[model samples]
Target: MATSGDETTAVRGTFGFNAPAEVVFGVLTDPDRATRWLPVGVTAEPAPGGRLLVRGGGHRAEYDVDIDPDRLEVRWRPATGTGPHGSARVGDAPAGGSEVSAEVRAPLDEDRLRRLLGETVTHLRRDVEDNFNAG
Candidate 1:
C-alpha cells in the first residue's frame, strides 16, 4: 500500500485463482456471492440506479457499480462524495486460470488499508475456488 497526498492510502495487488475470469467476475457482481467473499460481517445489496449499498463494521456507503463483461472488469466508486473506492480487472492467466488486479483507495492508514485489502482478497479467492469446485 502507498500513501497518496497526506491522508489517502492506495493499495494495489494481483491475485491468481484457479477459475475462469467469468467465474470470478460472476462472484464479484452477484450481491449474494459478493457478500460471501467480502470482509467478515460486511453486507452488500443492490441499490437504486445500479448502485450497491454496502454496510459493515459500523460503516455504510453507497457505490456506483460499473461492469464490462467483455473485458471481465468491474469497478465501483462512491455514489455521492468520495470516500473509499476500488476496481478489479479479471484476465485469463497464461497458465489456464484467472488473474485479478485489484486496487483500493481510502482515506485510511496504510496498515489498515493493506490489511483490509489482504483480507478481502484472501476471502475472494477462497470463495471463488470453493464454489468452482462445488459446482
Candidate 2:
C-alpha cells in the first residue's frame, strides 16, 4: 500500500511466510541474505553507526544500521540522491507464520514508490520460498 504527499510519500509492503520471526528477521538483517532478495549488492555492519548500501537498478538505499529484533529504521542522506530511508516491522503471524511489513518514506511519487516497494516484497517472497523454504 502507498499514500501520497507533497514532496514525500509513504509506501508499505507486507508479506507472510511459514517461518519463525527469528528466521525471517535473519534474512532481513543479514546483508548477504538481503542482497539475494532486495538488492544487487549490500555492504553492511551489524551495529549502530554501521553503514549499509543496497544498490541496484541505478539506485541505492544507504543506511546507518541500528539493529533491533522487531523494528528496522534507516535514515540515509544520499549524497547524489536516488536512495530511500525506510522502517520495517517484523513479527509473528497467525498459524505459526511470520509477517514482515516495511514502510518507506521518500521524496517520490506514489507510483514509483509503489513499484519499488512491490518489487522488494516480491523479491523477499521469492527468496524465502526458493532458498529458505525449499523442501
Candidate 3:
C-alpha cells in the first residue's frame, strides 16, 4: 500500500512492504544491499557525515549522509545544491510487515518526486522478496 500527501514543494509518501522493519532498515543502511535497490548508482558510507556519491547519466555528484539507527531513518542532501534534501524512514506497520515513509523537498517537482519514490518502492519490494523470501 502507498499513500501520498497533497504538497507541491515537497512530496510525502508511505509505502507498505512485506518485510520487517529491521530488514528494511538493513537494506537502506548496508551499502551493498542499498546499491541493489537504490534508483541511481550510489556509493555511500551510510553513516553520519559520511560521503554519498551518486552517479548517473555519466555524471557524478557527492552528497552528505546522515543516518539514525535509533530512528530508523536516513537523510541526504547534495554537497552543492541550494536545497533538495530527501529522507526515508522505516517503521512497523499496523497490520504487519513494515512501512517506509519517504520525503523529498524542493527543486524537484511533485511528479518527479512521486516517480522516484515509486521506483524505489518497486525495487525495494523486489529485492526483499528475492533475497529474504527465498525457500
Q: Number of the top candidate by TM-score?
A: 1
Q: Name the 10 consecutive residues with the lowest summed lDDT in model 3.
A: 1-10
lDDT of 2 by residue, 1-135 (tens): 667666688887777877766667777767656666663343333333456655555554566655675453333344345446777777889988788877888887888778767777777777766656664
Candidates ranked by lDDT: 1, 3, 2
Which scores better on lDDT, 1 or 3? 1
lDDT of 1 at 37: 80
lDDT of every model, 2 decimals = 0.86, 0.66, 0.73
What digit string (tens of lDDT, one per residue) describes model 3 on residues 1-135?
Answer: 223434336778888888788888877766657666766653334433466666654656677778899999999888875555688999999666999998877555667667777777888888877766873
TM-score of 1: 0.92
lDDT of 1 by residue, 1-135 (tens): 475874678889898888988888888778667787888888898888888899988989998999998888888999888888889999998767998999999898888888888889899988898888989
Candidate 2 vs. true structure, TM-score: 0.72
Q: Which stretches of candidate 3 lie over 4 Å from their true place?
A: 1-8, 40-49
Clashes of 1: 0
- Candidate 2, residue 52: Cα displacement in angstroms equals 0.6
Quote each prediction's TM-score: 0.92, 0.72, 0.77
Residue pairs clashing, model 2: none
Better of 1 and 2 by TM-score: 1
| Sliding window of 10 residues with minimal summed lDDT for model 2 | 39-48
Candidate 3 local distance difference test against the native: 0.73
Order of candidates by TM-score, top first?
1, 3, 2
